[model samples]
Target: MDIIPQIRAAMHTLLSTTTEAIAAAQQYVKRPDRAKFTPSTLVQTLVYGWLAQPTATVEQLAQMACRIGVDVSPQAIDQRFTLATADLLRQLVLASIQPVIAANPVALPILQRFASVRVHDSTSIGLPDALTSTWRGCGNATTGGGSTLKCGVQLDVLTGTITALVPTITGWN
Candidate 1:
């Protein structure tokens, strides 16, 4: 099946909703004066690229930015994945859900069995010693020098969308 149209439709829906969220949150005020990439542009470009190619790399993201007239380097694009960016993305994700659900209500009999279907999972990753101060990883029993980053995600099964992403340097909750 051709996926281009589906991707385009999804992108349009997400971008419009994210644009509205960015405006309401006044997210651009946090950026520096000479910032070339607005929060809306960055979110749109990253989401579109990921939707088009799930395994897309930073180089590919940079190319996508270029196509959208951003002209940013791969390093810059990678660096943009900071905590603030993650928070912005999370806000946009939450903001998009209401609109999507309102526009396309789920009426499948199988899905209607539950009030809400949420899937939760968590993972832990080892991090460099330097990030211990910033990220505050759990103390290692063997190698106390290293740190661990734990991330948890909650997805809405009916909508096939991520409802929450919780990142912590501490142990999983």
Candidate 2:
């Protein structure tokens, strides 16, 4: 079956999320020097353009904007997303889109009605390089190296979606 609809839906979702991120980020006025661009629209355009075809580029994004009559330049797009922190936007991409694109395991409807509850626990991703820092290091394990705290996240499993997730970050090494 064609996956165009699914991809289109995902693109819309990404656009909406990116828009919301910009709106939220705009409220934080703690920084005065931050240059302003249409954060929401720019991000939405980027994600939409990225999803629209097999080959998407910054130039293509600008073209898409032109097609939609948004009047954006390639440099403007870069300045909006790259020069700006847009940390909130990036965080949402990592936290939402990445996970959605990954293993979005959900409980079967038939299984959902069962009394049995699903459970998920902590998971870790170790870097190949040793983590040697001033504040943190590998734990006192002889094999793994110095006593750097283990890293990972604690996530809960649910029938329809992730109920909760707590990031497990090791302190500075």
- lDDT scores in order: 0.70, 0.53
Off by over 4 Å in 1: 1-13, 23-29, 102-173
Shift of residue 85 alpha carbon in model 2, Å: 4.8
- Candidate 2's displacement at residue 90, Å, is 2.7
Worst 10 residues of 1 by lDDT: 97-106
- Number of the top lDDT candidate: 1
Worst 10 residues of 2 by lDDT: 147-156
Runs in model 2 with CA error above 4 Å?
1-14, 25-37, 53-55, 83-86, 94-158, 164-173
What digit string (tens of lDDT, one per residue) describes model 2 on residues 68-154? 557867886665553234554545545554434433455678666665445656644443343444325344443254323332333
Indicate the residue-level lDDT of 48 in model 2: 64
For candidate 1, the lDDT comes to 0.70
RMSD vs true structure, all candidates: 6.2, 7.6
